[model samples]
Target: MTLILFTQIFVGLALVFTVAAFGWRLRLFNALARPVDRSTPKGNPRLGILYAFTLGMAPWAKESTRRHGIAYLRGVAFHLGIFLVLGILILSPWLYLLPVTWRTLLALGAALGALLGLAGFIARFAEHNLKALSTPDDYTAVLVVSLFQASAGLWLVYAPALPLFYIVSAIMLVYAPFSKIRHCIYYAYSRLFFGKFVGSRAVLPHSQQGAR
Candidate 1:
């Protein structure tokens, strides 16, 4: 095979496998010593789905470390910024397949939205890292998501051809599902379980009998 083809095959396979392995590791950890929570329920499928949807789409509505006023502003700004960018992502393929006008508007919204997210990322990193409030993985996770979004912005700035942009996006799609970024999808359900549901359930109750 040609060098370019060989490299793509090698890199893509390596990335895919590494991510899959990490996912397996996460599953093992979850099985062996689950994280503590005061929120999950006793396997109610309907409630589980509803909770997941609510948390995934509405994380900002929940309380935060920040108090009311600051939380309101931060949540509004972050979610609005995410919302605008997501709308643009939905529109991007159409822009590619359609006219310049469509492309221009989509590109503009995406560019500005990415910039906003980048700024928030920097602010969050400063707060978490410098303040020593973040775990190493937490900081790394933020950095990866920041890089992913920034890559999208860079793709826009350079106006790389469709193939290259697709390559970057594909890598991101594969990487995100394996990374802390998966929290975006699973966070809501996780919260519902650990937060609202945990306390309400009697199943998996604390052991009153002492271990011998």
Candidate 2:
């Protein structure tokens, strides 16, 4: 088989493995017992959930983000770039048909994201607390993802790099479910649980703040 064909097959199988792993994880999460709170709620659970997905994600919404605003923003941008790259990957077969301007813009975004990922990797080693908390898996995962983003950006600018990008993408996708990257899949559930707990206690969107 040609190099391109091999890359395509590798990526396809990687995608399938990723989907199956995530599905298993979802089932595992679902099988866990979720205890119901019988207590009366003082606030609106729906509103709290909305806040969890919205305002709660803002840099100023939490102390950690507020303290590390730049880092938080970097993370947000990196994730957005990942999402954009994923979309580009899906349309890669038809990429040549896209306008040059759009391709350039997308490439720029991917480059920026790769830079942010690199920054994160460096920070993990340079920051005292982060360094202390990080495991070898954390370093490997960040390095793989950063390289994937970089390869994607390069592929966007040079068609010859397509195989490299596909290889990196396949590696990242295959590793994600078993690594810290999988936390993304549980982000919504965590936020939902937090929103419900805080809403029931009227701890978030405090009644006093709501009144004002």
Candidate 3:
């Protein structure tokens, strides 16, 4: 009975997120804000490449953190941890607990990645709430996601009543579409859009574009 209910919940959330993401991609609810990529890089080609890479990270790394002192660490941890955790979670045999020699390494990598992500989130929350740079929506989104992640971690630790953890995860999945957390998907496209848009406008110097 519990397993059936949990399976239903998972299927339901998957359907909703998939449909909502498709809707978002269709520009159903997204406001058509014009491109805001006016900050042009200087003549240094290496600097321009660096700028492009950093712009890719800017979506997750809140702009507000720059006013505070945590922009570097927050940006680094958030991006690198996201990369590591996402990669290992998808590719590692640990996903199925399959017998493999690399399971320990993958487990450690995932743990460290999650920890790094938590640190980044903590830094963002401190800068936002404690420093007064956060909007109400910002605070709410961060609080919700932080709680969701912490709950997931706890569930993994206790291994108790998988249904309860599934409930929490389901809530996270539903909330993510409506919250700033959707930026996880939105950011990648935004980066490519920015790059192509800039290139079309002849904003990037030729030497930088030719760098292969």
Segments of candidate 3 deviating more than 4 angstroms: 3-15, 21-25, 29-70, 79-96, 100-130, 155-158, 205-212
Model 3 sits at a Cα RMSD from the real structure of 6.4
lDDT of model 2 at residue 139? 95
Angstrom error of the Cα, residue 42, model 1: value is 12
TM of each candidate vs. truth: 0.51, 0.95, 0.57
Instruction: Report residue 206 deviation for candidate 1 (angstroms).
Output: 25
Question: What digit string (tens of lDDT, one per residue) describes model 1 on residues 93-163?
Answer: 45445565655654565455455555555666666543476556555555444444444445444554433
Candidate topping TM-score: 2
Q: Candidate 3 lDDT, tens digit per residue, 51-160?
A: 45575345544465555545466545545544553353233223435444454454454445456556655665665465476556565665554444444344334445
- What are the runs in model 1 whose C-alpha is more than 4 Å off? 1-52, 55-61, 65-95, 125-130, 154-158, 161-179, 182-189, 192-212
Least lDDT summed over 10 consecutive residues: which range in candidate 2?
A: 203-212
**Candidate 2 local lDDT, 1-212, one digit each (tens):** 99988999899899999999999999999999988898877778877887888898889998999899899999999889888888878888899898888888889999998999999999998999999999999999988988888988899899899999999999999999999989988998999999878776677866774453
Score candidate 3 by TM-score against the native. 0.57
The per-residue C-alpha lDDT of model 2 at residue 138 equals 92
The alpha-carbon lDDT assigned to residue 155 of candidate 3 equals 37
- Alpha-carbon shift of residue 53 in model 3 (angstroms): 5.8
Question: What local lDDT score does residue 136 receive in model 1, on the 0 to 100 scale?
Answer: 61
| Model 2 CA lDDT for position 41 | 73
